[model samples]
Target: MTDTATPLISLTWTDHITGRRGHLVVDRLVRGVASGGLRMREGCTLDEVAGLARGMTMKEALHYTPGARYIPLGGAKGGIDCDPRAPEAYGVLVRYLQAMRPYIAHFWTTGEDLGLTQGLVDKAAAEAGLTSSIQAVYPLLDDEEAARRRLADAFAVEVDGIGLGELAGGCGVAEAVLAALDRARRPYQDTRVALQGLGTMGGATARFLTRAGLRVVAVADAKGTVANADGLDVEALLAARDAFGTVDRAALRADDVELPGDAWLSTDAEVLVPAAISYCIDSVNQERITARWVVEAANMPVRPEAEALLTARGITVLPDVVVNSGTNAWWWWTLFGDIGADADEALGHIRRSMRTLIDLMLARAEADGTTPRAAAHALVADRLPEIAARYGWYR
Candidate 1:
């Protein structure tokens, strides 16, 4: 069995100029290729980076198909333990990229996550004299287009006349939640959902679910939680929210009710989506979560023991590996599959892949009489030996 206890490579570096620290965790290497995101947030640590790296590895393994016929890129993650609001943050990022230059070129390709922006990422790559390693993944692109994209990436311009990529976690989670409801023979229109963390992923998820005919009764962000029994106006909420996804308290309608902190946990809802951060549902709060379906749109959003407790209480927890996989699906398709210049087509491909994968996991879990997480890990275990042999990582 593949050892999950240790990462293949874990490196820590300090920016002597600013006294900032950075970490890069490579969970595994397949054909010497690894890829993940670079996240910058206050209080970030090496251990969190390593855990996220491992999640990426599991995500790739769970989605792998033998017929794809390519060396699966292993998982890696990078983190900067600095307040993004600080003036020295940009300098710290540049220096961190410089320190990681060798690995970034030879083994790892990092992208934006959390507090990192595309412009900052491109600036760092330029400062480090590195080309777009992501281009290496798209071998099927026409020579002219490939050259054009490389130029665009080098100049930090739009590629194929499109802007930077977006987080599709919400799109994937919405599809997965639908798949889960369908499996349980529940009606989407009749379902009420309480969402925590109204940032990029959470905001998008709430919008999609509301559009899909689900009632988003409660929505929460770093600021606070707002609820309406008859369902909140998602479009209006989106209009009132800031770039960070915090809803304005004054924007609420007369009928809207402001709930206490953590009140979303006790809200009357059939589905709960935690899209904010890790361990949102822990030992103390797990007991109060009213949703029967907990769809995780954030990595490791549910603690292990909390997940167990919820399961015992008859709550079905859909894991992040399956529910929040839209971004990964988008990357895989852009690299290997034929995604043209259309954004809708690209998103459609991701939604379809997520639905298929969620269905497969649900079926497997049902057949094995186990949780979805366990079923996913079991599939990963079964595929590890084959993947290792295919890549010649082991005999």
Candidate 2:
């Protein structure tokens, strides 16, 4: 009954700075040198941390973590159960890092995660005196003007991070869908999409997908879903949206159906993106799923039961870890600078990696009479063992 795929390691930190306690869950250690972002959410729990760690496992398997795959490189995640918006959050963050210094010397590395910022990352690392030889000077780099020129020359596309509300998961979904479409020979020129979450990540992803020529057909938040088959005006929606990604239900009425909270899945569209939270799709609502392809923009949106049903029915479902594998990869890649010269180029590289991995997984799945999830697992299983043997983990 237990999922053996999940990794297990715990790093606990006590912050004297803000008088708080933080725990870093290194879900799974890939190649004994795994890394992930540090998230600070008020209600983060051990179960959530475990789920995230497992997500990282899938990510490292499908998308190459910084270390060589055959080198036992696995996935891990960390969560700080504290309100990041609180006034004394920074002090608490520094103290948390200091407390966590003991285990950090090992192969595990931590970066920024949801509800955290690069400023916090720099502050914590600086206070801990934990400097990486890779990017010896990890600059926060918030100066947009200076970065533009630097990024432009480094990579073809524009590079902007801190300025953008990092919709890492959504971005990964977009890349996955594009890759799926590419393999199906489906043109992304005017594909309609339904966005189920309008949070920071969801919003950012919607913008990117829209700009890339995908007509967003419907968008929904915690409140409800708004639909316009002729393609909902994403820009206007953003303008009208509040901070929580919720649009005023009273303001826009366009043949919208206000079903129960989970009605977003029923909306007709080529792709359905659930990036809001975990377990958005379960066995009960699994039958209502109509999207040709269900791309998980959120971590573990489709529960195991729901995923089994969907897979049995021949739906192409991309795993959350694979679909949302960008930010973590970017964080570690940043340390090496072995990816792209600039942010724009780096993102392009990341996107390409996501696309290729998806395409390869789907292809392998077809040939092996398996699901992409299984195919991805097989790929990781094969790769990790080889790496482990090389590093003498088993031998």
Candidate 3:
């Protein structure tokens, strides 16, 4: 494995509000605000948090935000190791809020990530006395309900010209998929996809693909996977999915086969999507993958080793920066316009961005004999220092 010093970044957060004092490992603070998501899971680690922050750094540079110039408001991320479903989560979250209060008031802004809910975010924001004015980097919705309303308003009425499946992250991915398909000169309709994790990102991506005329043969959630080689019943799946992507397996019919949790990886589809967790398809499970194309809908779903293995096998792997353009797009809109109008508009922008980035990256990879991951990194690395230089931050 290519080794480098722990990426230069600052990280300091309260382990437990009542326990240890919080710490900070900031590489460089651009302005008063450093934005990132908070991951609450049992397995979260410091290194992972730093990596995500690095990604934010790259993202901010690529987009050239105001801090992108004068200061480096690269992205920052924080995680608390706890299970969301556990009763302890609320207490832990409160402690987290209490510990992070000082930073949240100044140079750091935290948002919902894995295991974090809107209710939790609202509660924390309330206790912190957070308001719209505090949001110097991204525009903050007055409240969580407003954020949801914005999303609903944007998607409340579906456009007639767009297919139902062509509407979500799947649609965004579909754009990328189409680009990849075109580059290989392969026919689009014959392509099939099996999706792991059917949450907002996964569900949207699946639906969009279906609408784009690609067949979704398998889909899975935390509960279990449901497969139908002929094609999954997207309508039925959506009808049965709960607020948090849970499906009532009791209602599932006998015709559908239930497979172990990671069954989505073994499916015989042209494309595979690991849209669940970060590093879900790590080195251990990388060998079992059967798809020729792997698209990342979730952030950092594949580790370096797994990604390298896939690349060596002649598989097309799309990096999260380009493939998971959905969230970044939303964040941009949230930071700029009124959150309400920007939610849906953000999705449209994400699709276009992913399509364009992927198309460009693939062409570059093929022409240069470099892997997709390397190509994406090179692209980010090239632009980041430029942003730093332009802003006169590097000197």
Best by lDDT: 1
Tens-digit lDDT string for candidate 3 (1-395): 11122434555565544343223333334443566667677767777777777666554544443431123354667777777777666676766766666666666666666667444676766665664212444333345555545544554445443322224445566677777877777776788899987766777777778877788888888877888787877766766777566667765666777887888988989989887788888887888888989988777889988888888888878877667654544454443442334335555666666667787678778787998777776776766656556543422
Most accurate candidate by TM-score:
1
TM-score of each: 0.89, 0.76, 0.82
Model 3 CA lDDT for position 75: 62
Which runs in model 2 stand beyond 4 Å of their true positions? 1-8, 11-22, 28-32, 65-73, 81-98, 105-107, 119-171, 237-261, 341-344, 392-395
C-alpha lDDT of residue 259 in model 2: 57
Q: What is the lDDT of every predicted structure here?
A: 0.78, 0.66, 0.65
Question: Which scores higher on lDDT, 2 or 3?
Answer: 2
lDDT of 1 by residue, 243-333 (tens): 5568988888999999876888889999999887777789889989878899998778899999999999999999987787677656655
Model 2 has an lDDT value of: 0.66
Cα lDDT, model 2, residue 166: 57
Candidate 1, superposed: residue stretches over 4 Å from native: 1-4, 69-71, 133-164
Query: Ten-residue segment with the worst summed lDDT in candidate 1?
Result: 155-164
lDDT at 88, model 1: 91
Tell me the lDDT of model 2 at 324: 77
